[model samples]
Target: MRLALAQLEIESAAVEDNRERAEAAVAEAADRGADLVALPEIFNVGYFAFDAYQRAAEPVEGPTLSRIADAAREHGIGVLAGSIVEDLAETESVETPADEGLANTSVLFDRDGRRLAVYRKHHLFGYESAEARMLVPGESLGVAEFEGATVGMTTCYDLRFPELYRDIAAEGADLILVPSAWPYPRVEHWQLLPRARAVENQLFVAAINGSGEFDDAELLGRSTVYDPWGTTLAGTGDDPDLVVTDVDLDRVAAVREEFPAWRDRRL
Candidate 1:
């Protein structure tokens, strides 16, 4: 499949403008013949725009995602609609006792504008951030099928947890999409973890991150795609980019069979 990494340059609290930017990027990706387009995390309100979280939070079926779903249908391409600060109450399915707080949620839209899966971020960052205190941690894992690949979704901080990836892998996922808002000074970690997960699991990994600076932090926009062999297929610098590349879904099984790493795993 040909994938487009929409490394958006998110603006702080500029919801309407950022939505427009993402729409245009989706169009560009379609024009470039990408079968699927994955966006950066929190591209709508900017990840570090902590104050805007409460105000910008919307329901799962809110206008922001509706617009993106329309774009995906119009372009006849599947889309990983980055992520949004979601008011869980808006989507009754996600509501829980912690519905009093918000959830960092990601949605997947098929080419026909169908909502396939919704994944709230499982790991909330606690290192000098309000996420842990403000948002409810997600409790479930989500996986779907797209273009002959079993796809799964995860957010930025979740990449640091191998058990989560292993769970998805055990469920027969071949390609995992990570929407991120990774910041500067941790570029090495950003580069290392995704490739490590891909090589160890023998599955394709696509990590899409945002660009631009917020009041409290700056994003490192190295959106990347790694093959099952841990080879870097496509990557961007620290800037807004549409990193597009093709990946063979068949390679996942080939690599797993040839490497035998999965066969060596022990409890």
Candidate 2:
């Protein structure tokens, strides 16, 4: 399937401007005849824009996701919407809760406007700041069939965890999609981690990240796609641009057949 990765710049807390940018990028991806279009993590509201979550967070059926579904249906292309703040009303409190705070959520939609799955970020980054304090970590990773391939879904922080990828791989996922808002200094990790996961798991990895600086942290937008052989098929350099690549799903089968590393694993 032909995937268009929108590696674009996002201004922290500016939802309107970011939405315009994302819309344009999706349109551009459609123009290129891409079967699936993916965006970076929290492109609507910048990742460092922590304060915006309360205001920017909306339900999965709300504007942000609704717009994406419409776009996917309109253009006849599947969409891998990057992370957004999802308000969970299902788990609301009586005293102070209209809804439980925020979840770093990635929503996928098929060309027919069907909600494929919702994968919230299971690993919330709390090593530095207090992401766990505000954001609710997702319960599980999600896999869905889209664009003729079984795609495993993960968010930014989840990329650092190899077990998550391995679990998905064991579930027969051929391609992995990671929507991230990785910051600078860790730029190398953002680039290297995904490739390493691809190599180890023997699956195609498609990582999408946001560009531009936000607050005190700058997002190093080096969105990348790696083949099953760990080849860098496409990569960007901390800039706002789209990386388009055609990924042949059959390669996953071919590589696993030749190497047979996954099958030989004892543990």
Candidate 3:
């Protein structure tokens, strides 16, 4: 299938503007005959716009994901709407309507606008401060079959966990998708980790990251795609551009057939 990754800038809690841009990018991808489009994580609110989470968080059925769903249906293309500040359903005890289940959630919409899956970030990044304190960690790993490939879902910090990818692969995922807001000073890790995962797991790894500078941090935008043989099929630097590429599922079979490493694994 032909896949396009939209790596762009977020407007720091500006939902409408980011939605418009995301719509435009989806349209562009559709015009190019893409089967699926993957967007950057938290494009509505900048990654470092931590202060705006409370004000900008929306429910799963809210306008943010609904907009992407509408766009996906309109274009007759699949969409991997990046992470959004999710406002969960109202609880019994909490009086404040504002205090909903706030999670960093990623939603996938099929060509018909039906939601395929909603994967929240299982691993929260709290290295410097406390992302876990603010957001709720996900309970389940996401997996789905789309465009003839088994797709696995993950967020920014989940890249550090190899077990997640291994579990996805064991569950029959040939391509693992990571929607991230990974920052700089550790750009080397960003580059190395995904490729290493691809090499080690013998599967395709696709990372879609944000570009441009946030409030106090700058995301290293190197949205990329790797083949099953651990070769760079397509990649971009720290710039906001759509990285589009076509990957055949047959390649995975061919590589595994030739190497036969997975069959010999004792673990």
Candidate 4:
């Protein structure tokens, strides 16, 4: 499968402009024959733009996702519409009544614009940030099939937790998509974690991060794709870029069979 990672430059609270840029990136990726296109975390509203979270938050079927679905159908390619600030109160899908909370959510759409899976971030960041206090944590893992690959979804802070990736892999995921808004001063950790996940889980990991500054933080936009063997297939620098690369889904099986480490695991 050919995957496109869009490292978009996000501006704080500029929802419309960000959506337009994301759509254009999807179109460009599709034109280049990308089977799937993924965007960075909170591409519409900057992650550190905490003040805009409530105002920009919307339901699962809000205009943000609708526009992304249109792009997916228009290009005939699957899309991972990164993470969004979801207003739980505005949504009709969930049963419980959390009348005053929001969740950080990621959505997946098929080539024909069919909704595949939705992943709300389980691990909310709190390192000098207010995500934990502002958003309600998600309760489940996300996995789905697309173009002969079992894809999984996780957000930025989720990368720090290997058990989460293992759980998703247990649910039959071979390709993991991570939408992140990771900031600077920790680029080392950013680079190390994804590769570690790919190698340990024996699955492909594609990490898509954003570029640009927010308040007092700046994103380290080194979006990367790793094969099962922890080999870097494609990566971008600390800039806004569209990194496209081909991946062999069958390699996952091949690597597992050749290494056989997963079978040796014990309690």
For residue 267, give model 1's deviation from the true position in Å. 3.2
lDDT assessment of candidate 3: 0.84
lDDT of 4 by residue, 225-260 (tens): 999999999998999999999999999989999999
lDDT of 3 by residue, 1-267 (tens): 998999977667777888888999899999999999998888888777888888888877788888999999999999998788887653232122244567888888899888887788888888874578898777777888786788888888898999888888899888888888888889889888899888878888899998878667788899999888779999999888899998887787778889988777888
Q: Top model by lDDT, which number?
A: 4
Clashes of each: 0, 0, 0, 0
Error of 4 at 120 (Å): 0.3
Give the distance in Å from residue 40's predicted Cα in candidate 2 to where it truly belongs. Answer: 0.9
TM-score of 3: 0.94
| Candidate 1 lDDT tens digits, 145-230 | 88678998999999999999999999999899999999988989999999999988899999999998988789999999999988
C-alpha RMSD values across all candidates: 1.2, 3.0, 3.3, 1.2
- The Cα local distance difference test for each model comes to 0.91, 0.85, 0.84, 0.92
At residue 246, give the lDDT of candidate 1. 92
Residue 79, candidate 4: alpha-carbon lDDT: 96
Q: Tell me which residue pairs clash in candidate 3.
A: none
Better of 1 and 3 by TM-score: 1
Rank list by TM-score:
4, 1, 2, 3
- Residue 236 error for model 3, in Å? 1.1
Looking at model 3, how many pairs of residues clash? 0
Name model 3 segments beyond 4 Å from true: 90-100
Evaluate model 4: give its lDDT: 0.92
Q: In candidate 4, what residue range of length 10 has the lowest lDDT sum?
A: 91-100
